[model samples]
Target: MIDAPRSRYQQVADLIREAIQRGDYAPGSALPSQPTLAGKYGINQTSIGKAIALLRREGLVRVIKGKGAYVREIPPISRYAVTRYAEAVRESGTARGAFDAEMAQRGHESRTELVQWGETVAPQVASDALDLTAGAKVAIRKRHMHADDVPVQIATSYVPWELAKGTAIAEQDTGSGGTYSRLAEAGHTVERFTETIRSRMPTPEEADFLRLDEDQPVYDVLHTAWTAEGRAVEICVHVMPTTQWVLHYEWPAS
Candidate 1:
């Protein structure tokens, strides 16, 4: 049996992908206009649009409504599960959190914008993770994290109101080492962390905040910080774009 011919859009997509791989279209550079691509490929604008859409879904390019499509600039960031949470690094006083330390080590400028910080009723997830009552109050800290000035992740942390009340964790800055450090200072040292991760398409708000195209998906990570006595001290929700991150993990083979 012979293989059938590929569709026009598929062919166009392949050509464009090849050009991108060959560096003809540099990362963060705009691709040719639809009309130009159409004329150059002897294809209609509809096919060109479909081709670009296909590329967008493949994580090769991003489409801007008024500006047109551009090659995706952000490289995949490797998230080291274990070392990122090292107590020594947090106590070093040079970085605020794992995100800041990792970005600085990678030679990228890191920034955190405090979106919301205050006491609020615990959400179901937070309540369950922190073993709090359904209507229990909790201190909330929401931050938008950036690397190289590009939006990368959103982290929102929740702690039992009594634990965080009148503490630096309730403040916008959280001093050094971030929430974990403050928790340690408050006699709730985190001995270990549990993270549950899932992936889904970005919501309208998340897409807008992260500047993500419709085709991009995001990782929702529920992180629970626990103490040596097995009490949950903090619950944090981390949302990151899938195209911009690669989670890494390692453990002893004992």
Candidate 2:
């Protein structure tokens, strides 16, 4: 039996993918118009649209309304789960958080923008994670993080009001070691952390804020810092574009 012939859109997608790999279209650069691509490939505009759509779904290209499709510039950054939270890593006297230190190690510029900070009613997830009653007020610290100037992650942390009020943890800038250090100073002393991760399509607001395509998915990470005495001190929700991160983990065999 003979193999079936690929569709025109598939052929076009292959060509575009090859061109992108060959650097014919540089990353972050827009592709030619649909008409131009159709003329070049001798196909209809509808086929061109389908080809671009295929590329978008494959995480190779992103289409913007009225702006055309552009190559994705940012590469995937590795998230080292085991070492990122090591005491020495954050307390190395650099005054940088785990994300910043990781970025610097890989030669990428990183920045964290404090979007909002203050006390607020705890969301259900936070309430449960931190063992707070529903509708209880908590201190919130929200931040938008960038890698090489590209928005990549959004993290919102919730702390019990009793622990955060009048503390640096509620402030815009936490001193060296960030919130964990501040928590330690305040007698919380984080002994370990737990994270639960899941992936889902981006919401409209997330897409707009992260400049993501409608079809791109995001990793939702729920992180909790716990104390030696079994108290949950902080709960943070981390959202990151699926295309821009690679999660890494390691543990002892024994």
- On the 0 to 100 scale, the lDDT of residue 65 in model 1 is 88
Q: Enumerate clash totals for all models, in the order shown.
A: 0, 0
> lDDT tens string, model 1, 71-102?
97767788887888784365455224678877
Badly placed stretches (over 4 Å) of model 1 are: 1-8, 87-95, 213-215
**What is the C-alpha local distance difference test score of candidate 1?**
0.86
Error of 2 at 86 (Å): 3.1
Worst 10-residue lDDT window for candidate 2 reads: 87-96
Clashes of 1: 0
